[model samples]
Target: MGEIIYLRDQHFAEFHDKCFLLLSASNHIELSRQLTKTLHHMLVTKNTPVALYHYLPTGQLRLIYYFSFGSNIEYEDEISSIRSFEALSHSQLTYYALNGEHETWGYVAHPPSSYIGSTHWISSLVDIAMHQLGLLSAKCIDRQQAKLKTSRRLLSKDIHLFTNIEEILDRHRQRWRDIFHACGICLASQGALHRFGHCPSDHQLLQQLSWLSNDAEQTDVIEFEGSHQGSLAVKLSLAGTHHGWLLLFRDQPFTNKHVDSAIHRALSCWLTYEARMARVLADDLALTIAALEISHTNRQFITTAQQLASLKPAIHSAPRAVTSAEQNNK
Candidate 1:
C-alpha cells in the first residue's frame, strides 16, 4: 500500500475551493500543475496514479504532467518523450480521452476500487479545467503581447491576428519590417513560406526548422542562428506541427535583450490563431466537397444536353413525314 492523499468528495466546499486554484494559474505549466494536484487530492486510493498526455499529429500522446502517490512505476521516472501507450494500457489503466473531436489529449490512470470521487465527476472537472486553461492561454498571450510590444525599441509591433491567411501575412510583412532598425523579418507556417527581405532563407531555415516540429513538450521559445551573417530566428511551436518561425535579416545588428522575447510572445498568439484556422479549414473542406458535388451534377446535365443536341442532327437528317399541304404543293 502506497501513501495516499486525503480523499475529498465532489460536492464539498473544499472541492470548488480547490478547483478555483486552477483559475488563478498564470500560464500553461502552472495550470497543469494545479490540475495534477487537484486530481491527487480527490482520489482516496493509493497507487491510483494519473498521467496527463498531449496528443500529437503523429498519432502518439506525449506525456506532459504525471502525478502519483508513491507508485513504483518505471515509466514515470522521466516526464518527457513520445513513448507508445501500448505497454501503458497493459497495466489495466483507464484512459479518459479529452478534446474528443479535436484529438488534443487525455489522462490515463490506474484508479483503485476505493477511489473517492466518481470517475464521471473527475472527468467533467478535468475537462472544465482544460477549457479554463485554453481561455487562460489566450488571455496570457494577449497580456504578454501587449507588454512586449511596448518594450520594442525601434519598430512598431503592429501585427494583427486575423482569420484570413493572406491578410495576416500582409499585416506581418508590414509590421515586422523593422524588427531591428531595418533588419527584415520573415514569418512562415502552415505550408506557406514568405520572405520579406533578402536574407538567406534557404539553408538556415531548412536545417534548423525541423527541430520545432518534434513531439517534445514545448514550453519555451527556441532561438538559434539564421546564418553566419549575424542573422537570427525565433521559433514558437506547440504540440505537433503547430509551429512558426520569425527570421531577421542581417541589415541591422540588434542589441536588445528582449527583441526575441517580443517576437516569441507574438508568435505564440500566431500559432494559436493558425491552429484555430486549421480546424476552420475542415469546415471549409466540407463546403468544397458540397461545391464539387454540385459541379458534378451540373456537368452530368450538360453532357446529357450535348448528347441530345448531337441526336437532333441525326433526327433532322432522317426523312420525316411532311405536312399534307406541303406535299401537295411539291
Candidate 2:
C-alpha cells in the first residue's frame, strides 16, 4: 500500500557468501513453510544448499527448511554444525525485535556459482515479501493482545472469588508452566512464596526471595547461576495485600523480557487470589471464635437457670400455710 522498501545495494556485501532476509511476520510457521517450499523449488532448479531460519519473538528459533544440492564434504559438515549449534548460540545469526512488535526472520544460504543470478532474484522476491509480512505481523499482534486481554479479565474475575491459598499457588504454578511452554522454554520449578512453607530449598531461590522481599518494586527479574544451569525469579507483589516470587529454571540462560507483560498479568491474578484468601481465612477464624463464645454463654446461662430452680423452694413457700387455721388467720 505504501512505498515498497528494499535492501540497499551497499548492503549486498552482507549477502556475498550467504544471504539473510528478515520478515517482520508473526505467522512464522506458515511463512517459514511457504518459504521452504519456494526455496526447495529454487534448489531443484539451481542445485544449491539453502537454509531458512524462523525465529519467533517468544525465543524459539528453528531451522524450518534446509536443502542440499550436492554432497560436498565441507558444505555438509558446515550444515551439520549449523543445525546442531546455530539455534543454541547467537554467533551464526542475529535476532532483534522489529519495532518492538514483530520478530526478525533470518535466512542464510550457500549457493553454487551457477545460481548467482537466481540468488539475486530470490533476494528481490524476499524484499517484497518482507513488506507484506510486516502488515500481517501488525494484525497478528493485535489479535494476540486482544486474546491476552480477555484471558486476563477472566483470571481476575476468578481470582477475586478464590478462598484457598493453595488454589492460588497452584494457579500461579500452572500459569508459569503455560508461559514457559508458550515461549518454548523448559520450566524446572515454580511456586508461590512462603516464609517457611513449600518454598524451594535451593540457596539461590532463597537468596532471590530475600532480595525480592527487601525491595519488590526495584526488581522484576533475578538471575541465578548455580547448580541449575539457568534460574530466573520474577518478583510478585501487591503492596500490603500480598508478596511472593516465581522461580523458573531452564537449561540455558535467557532473558524473560519477551514475556514480561504476560508475567505481570499472571502476578496480578495471583496477588488478587492471595489477598482474597487472606480475607477469607481471617473471616473464618472470626466466625469460629464467635461461635465458641456463643456456645460458652449459652452453657453458663443454662447452669445459672438450673441453680436458681434448685433454690426456688427455699426462696419462696408455696401454699405452706394452707390449713384451716392459717386460712382463718389470714
Query: In model 2, where do residues sit more than 4 Å from their true spots?
Result: 1-26, 44-47, 54-105, 111-113, 164-330
Name the 10 consecutive residues with the lowest summed lDDT in model 2. 264-273
**Alpha carbon lDDT of each predicted model:** 0.49, 0.41
236-272: candidate 1 lDDT, tens digit per residue: 3333323455554443222223223222221111223
Cα displacement (angstroms), candidate 1, residue 307, comes to 73
Please provide, for model 2 over 1-330, each residue's C-alpha lDDT reduced to its tens digit, 9 standing for 90 to 100.
223334455434343222233353345444544444455454444445454544433343334344443444434434334422344353432222222123354444443434333344465446545555566655655554554454455445544555444444444444433433222212122243332223345565566656656864544444343343244455433333233444544432222332222221211111111222223322332333333445567779999999999999887876555689878898
lDDT of 2 at 268: 12
TM-score of 2: 0.39
Shift of residue 169 alpha carbon in model 1, Å? 22
RMSD of 1: 16.7
How many steric overlaps does candidate 2 have?
0
lDDT of 2 at 189: 22
